[model samples]
Each structure stands twice: as C-alpha cells, then as structure tokens.
Target: MKRYESWGRYPTIRDQKVLTISSRKAPLPLPDDERSVLPYGLGRSYGDSCVNDNNAIIDTSALSNLIAFDPNTGILRAESGVSLATILKVFVPKGWFLPVTPGTKFVTLGGAVANDIHGKNHHRAGTFGRHVSQFGLIRSSGEHLTCSPTSNSDLFRATIGGLGLTGLVTWVEIKLVSIKSPYLDTRTIKFRNLDEFVEVSRENDPVYDYSVSWVDCTTEGDQLGRGLFMAGNFSERRKSRQPKSLSIPFPCQAPSWLLNSYFMRSFNTLYYNKQLSRTVDALTHYEPFFYPLDAILDWNRMYGKRGFFQYQFVVPFDEKGETIKEIFRRITRSKRASFLAVLKTFGDIESPGIMSFPRKGITLALDFPNDGAPTLALMKELDTIVLQAGGSIYPAKDARMSHEAFLASHPRLAEFEPHIDPRFSSSFWRRVRN
Candidate 1:
C-alpha cells in the first residue's frame, strides 16, 4: 500500500495503486479487476478524502481544458480539472468573477463541486454548485450521465456536496456572474469582544456581498473575541501588478514554531491593528480582497513541519450562542490559539446542490498546526459540540474525522451512496460507510 497525505503532508495515507496523468494525449482508466477508484486534484484537501488505500487513484490536474463559453450570458463550460485560478486569469479581464469562491483559487472546479463550496457572497448567490448548471459524471455502471438540476437531480445534488463519492466528475457547466471591475471597495471595522462582534455582524453581514472576521481566541475576559470585521463591494480598478515573487515557491518550508500560540497572537495583533477601523479603502484588483493571503505563496508552510488542520463548522442561527460559545470556551481553555479565526454569516439554504453545507446561520473556521497527542482529542471533543447542536463540520477543511463522526456531520450522506461505485470511494467515504 502507498500513503498519501495533504499539501501539508501532516497525514500519510496507505494505498495500493496510484496513477498520475499529465496530458490529454495520455488517457488512463482503472483495470477491470480494480476494486475502487478516487480522483485527486491539487492535493489541497487536508485529509484522506483523496486517499483510497489498496484501490485505484486518478490525478486530474492536467485534464483541464476550456471547452466553451457563452459570451451572451457568461456561462462557462470546461473540463472538471480546471482551476479557479485559471478561470480568474481569463475572465477577470473581461469583467467576470466567480459567483462563489472559497478562500483560495487553486482548487479545481471538480473539487469545488464535490465540496459545494461557498464564499463571502454566499448570503447572496449561494454556493459554487448553485451556480453550476450541470456536470458529466461516470457512474458505477460505467455510464456517463449528463446530470443537472432537472435531470438526475438526485445524483446532481449528491455529487455537489457529496465529498467526491458520487462518481468521477468529467466536466462541469458553470454560470459566471458579471462584475463592475476587478477591484474591491472594502471597509474594515474593529471590535472589542465577542458580543460586539455578534452585534456588528447582525447589523452589517447582510448588507454586504462579502463579510468576514479575523478574531483572537487566546485572550480572556472582555477581550475574548477582539478582532477585525471586513465588508466589501465591487469597485473599479486601475491595473494589477505582476511579480514573480508572488508565485508559489514549492519545496520551501518554514520553521516548526511558525504557528505556535505566541507567534499566532502576534500575527493576529498585527492584522487586527493594521486598519484604524471603519475606514473605506480601495484595493488594486480583486487579488487583495478575494485573495489577501495569496501574496505570500506557500504560506501554508507557516504551519511548520507538523502542518495545520482547519476546523470549519457552521452552526444554525438557533445554536450560535449556546453551541458555538461552548466550542470557543474549549479552544481557549486548551490554549490552542489559532493564527486565523474567521466568522461569516450564511444566507438562504435552498442551494443548488444536494449535500451542500450552508444553512441559516453563522460559520466559524479555526486553523491550528498539528501539535500532536491531545490536540486531536480536543478537536474531536469540539466536533461533538458541533454535531450535538445539529450543525456539521466541513469535509474540505477536515483532516481527521471518524465514521460515526462523519455520519453525525452529514446525515444526508447515505442518500447518494447507491449511485457511487464501490471501487470509487475515498478514505472519507470509507469512514462514513463503515
């Protein structure tokens, strides 16, 4: 068996067969005797979702190709392997942007569909799957089905947020939204405590297309949730600067203490105090707004040799104070100070996908470099708090979660299992299935 981890390399997976494809001239499929298959992207997922031990694997990065575009409506159709970064390079100049984008643009369209990702505009446009018109899927029966909201809706729904278990996604048809320009008019606000943060979010999160917070969790007393809140709208841009230093430098690593609590707190302070508060600022292109962290490529290396785990969960409006509070209390008490803590409000729930993660409530994401031993245990404890409150964790950001935990997090998982090929499951699916 071979082992596969993540871009972080924190976890190693064991498997039997692995396939890497780079060109359209080269096509590779599983042997008839193969037991299972799993498609991998940029290997960005922080867990075993792309790892299928003793089974078959397909790497899809090189399969990217733009098929067609409807200049009239801005609808785009392309191979599933196309990266959001690629789309940005093409459409941004044409005054188009993704209706829904996660934190990073390095993810594949197929990966976005599998996760049913959402972004700052989620409260307005829903999810990536919501904007996707249709996709081509290969089922266990070896039948390539053209699925959409109208036909094969079941598979369509399940495949969107089903964690890449439904089938092998071949291509996707997506609907793009028009933007004023490639710049962002953003406002940054400061808060003193958790209560203030919630109060401001209740007031502004809905009015803006993008709303997020960078909070400090290590502080105690009234400073518990002191942080920065940002709201953004589309604005005109002048031009963008291109620098080779901005590119991701692979094979580069950081020191082991990069994410230690002391360093994280310092970084948090720097970020929180950067802006004076409630000030209007115009940025150069969407790059700074939608992708501020993108400037420092390989920033993930800041997690050190152990890497980091992103604990992202959404709690319905009804459970924020009661349930979310409990989670925060645990993290603070354990001294696991995250370098980055983001909180955002979700909009409508009727997203275009079946297994989407959005609901009527608030979502929180915490990043922690794996420190070993009780750290994982503490995260599991936090997991129970999320599950018990009727909320679920995000699979895309997950690095470790058990079968029972997966079941608790995604009760809708089994609804689409019948359509999945037994030989096409990942360690993520295996956990939930077992």
Candidate 2:
C-alpha cells in the first residue's frame, strides 16, 4: 500500500489507487473499482484538497511537455504538469517571467490555475487565472473542451480556483510578463503597528510592482502588528551570471517542543530588530525576494510528525482595520505564536474564477503547529471573526473548515457546483460539501 500526504504532511492517506496520465492526448483513466477520482499534480497543496483517501487519484506529473512558445509576444503554451521552477529555469535567462507567482515556484502550472494563486504583485496583476489565455480540460465523460474567457467560458472560470473538482486540466496557455533581469530593487521599512503598515502600503503599492509584509504575531499593546514591510520592482541592472541556487535539507521531524511560544517570541524579537535602521534599500535576487522559504527543503517537517496548519483569511477593508486588530488580539491572548506571519493587502482587481480567494482587502496568513484540539479551537474562533467580517479562507491551505463556514464564505458555490465533473471528487470536497 502506498501512502500519500499533502505538503503539510497532515491527515496522511494510505493505500490509495493511482493512475498515471502520461500524454496530453491520453483519455481520463478510471480506477478498477470504478470509484470517483481527483486530479493530482505536484501535491503542493497544504491540505487534503489534493488527496482522495481510499479512492483513486489521476497523476498528471508526466504530462510535462512544452507545446509551444512565442518569444515575440511573451506567450507560452505548456502541459499543465510543468513546474514554475522549470519555466523559470528555461525562460528567466530569456527575459520572461511569470506574471504572478506564489511564495514558492515548486508548484505545477495546473495547481496554480486550480487555486488561482496570488502573490505580492496581486494588487497590480491580479490572480494567476487572469493571465491564463486558455487551457484544455478533460472531463471524465470523455469531453475534451478548450476553455478561455471567450471560449467555453463557464468551464474556464470554474476550473480556475475550482480546486480540481471541475475536471483535469491537460494543458495551459498563459501570457508571460517580460523582465529585464532576475533581480528586484527593494525597499524595506520597519513599521510600529498595523496603522503604520497600512500607511506604508498605501504610499508604496501604487509605485511598486511587488509588495508584502512579515508581521510579528506575538506582540501586543503598543507593539501590536509591528513588522517589516517590503516593496520591490524589477531592476534594470543586469548581472552576467544568474544567482546560484542553494537548499538546506531538513532530514527529519523536529521535536514538538522546538517551536513553542517561547521560542517564537524570542525569534520574532531578534528577526524584527535585525534591521537597525528604520528603512533600508537594496537590489536583491528574485529567489530570496520571492521564495525565501523554498531555500529550506521539506521545511514543513519543522512542525514535527503532527504537522501544521496555515490559517489564512482575507477581511474586507474596514474603517480602521478593527476586525484584523481584534483577531490579532485573540491570537496573542491565546499565546499561540506563529513563526511565519504574513500580512498583505489584495487589490480591487477581480479574478475570473468563480471560487477565487483573493479580494480587495487585507489578508493575514499564520503557521500554527498542530496541538490537536487546542489548535482547532483557535482556528474555529478565528473563523467566526472572519465570517463576521465577510472574509473567506483559502481552501488550498485549509485542512479543516466547517461546511457552514465554507458555504458562507463562498456565496458563488451554487454557480460553481454545477460545473464540477460528476465523476470527480476529493477528500476536501466531500468534507466541506457534506
């Protein structure tokens, strides 16, 4: 029996049947038992969205051929299994880059489209689905449809951010953004609280191509929401040699006590104070600027064998960001520290996908080591606050969210439900839909 797990390594599924689709022209494969199956890509999703439990999964990693590329127009067509890292390796030197990328480049093109992944530049470029020119989806009933904004438009919008419930995306055609070099001229500012952070973001977002912030989630009172704000734009100064890639391997699970609140508080203090000056500017390589966490291989293991959950939610902009501040207060009161707390604002630009998570608001993502019921309790508390604020959780990173919460957050679920392929299902879909 083969065991499979999502990137978070939680809720491991054992003895699931697997089918491989190696070619773009290959028809959808069915399990011998005739059970419903879901499309599985690189399995980078942090939760059960990519798993099917005792059922079957169609592996699409082998369908990774680049079909075509038009360097003149910055358009490229490739199989869905191609990783963003692969595209960067082959095209970054050629002066082309992904219009929008998540924190890591290890995810497959198909996964990115399915989740409608957003990045620091989301305020300007919108979600990844906005740049997708078209894609080919293979339904279980042998329907091969070409989807785009103006062609097979319904499926196109459904598949993007549909969580792979719609169908299997065989190939994706995307419009790439041109770049002069693989470097960013960055400005880093230290903010005292949420107000300072918002002010800095408002002043810089219009001018910067990319912007994100690292928030300290353990602080309270006068220092609540204090963190570093980073803004960047493509640099014209080109380097003759591409930066060398380096990764430090995490060989085994870390001790459960390793990442306790005490450790996090100490670490956060040092990290925030590392920059002595109020503001600093530098030209940095894209790798560190965008995917710093990728440098630590299998970093999820740091949460130990129990794994971790990333609670990410976006609340619409309020008069003074009071909802966000209250949520932060609850977290600090609980004394459950998050090592990687990211706070950013999404733009008004809407995504074509019916289920896309990003909206015009502030989003905060936190990594919490799973301490069983206590952790779940904290999440439930936070979910209530988000729900009241009309915010939604990112399904890609969700391991557990109530069916009611899912429906409340995604008001368009009715429209997207009819588009889901009848023969496809996933652990997450079943959990939330039920």
lDDT tens digits, residues 244-271, model 2?
A: 8899989889999888889999999999
Which residue pairs come into collision in candidate 2? none
lDDT of each: 0.76, 0.92
Kindly report which residue stretches of model 1 are placed more than 4 angstroms away from their true locations once superposed: 1-4, 20-28, 236-245, 248-251, 278-280
Q: What is candidate 1's lDDT per residue for 1-434, written digit by digit as tens? A: 22345655656556547666564334446756857778887667776676676677777877799999998998999888899999999997787888888878878998899888888887877888878899888766667788998999888888888777777787899988888677777777788877778888888867778878878787777677788888887865545554332655444667776557787667778877787745545553577667777677667777777787878888776634667667777888887767778888788757766577787677898887788877898889988888888888887777687777777776666576676666577766666567
Count clashes in each candidate, considering only residues at least 3 apart in sequence or on different chains: 6, 0
TM-score of each: 0.92, 0.98
Model 1, position 132: C-alpha lDDT score? 88
Q: So what's the TM-score on candidate 2?
A: 0.98
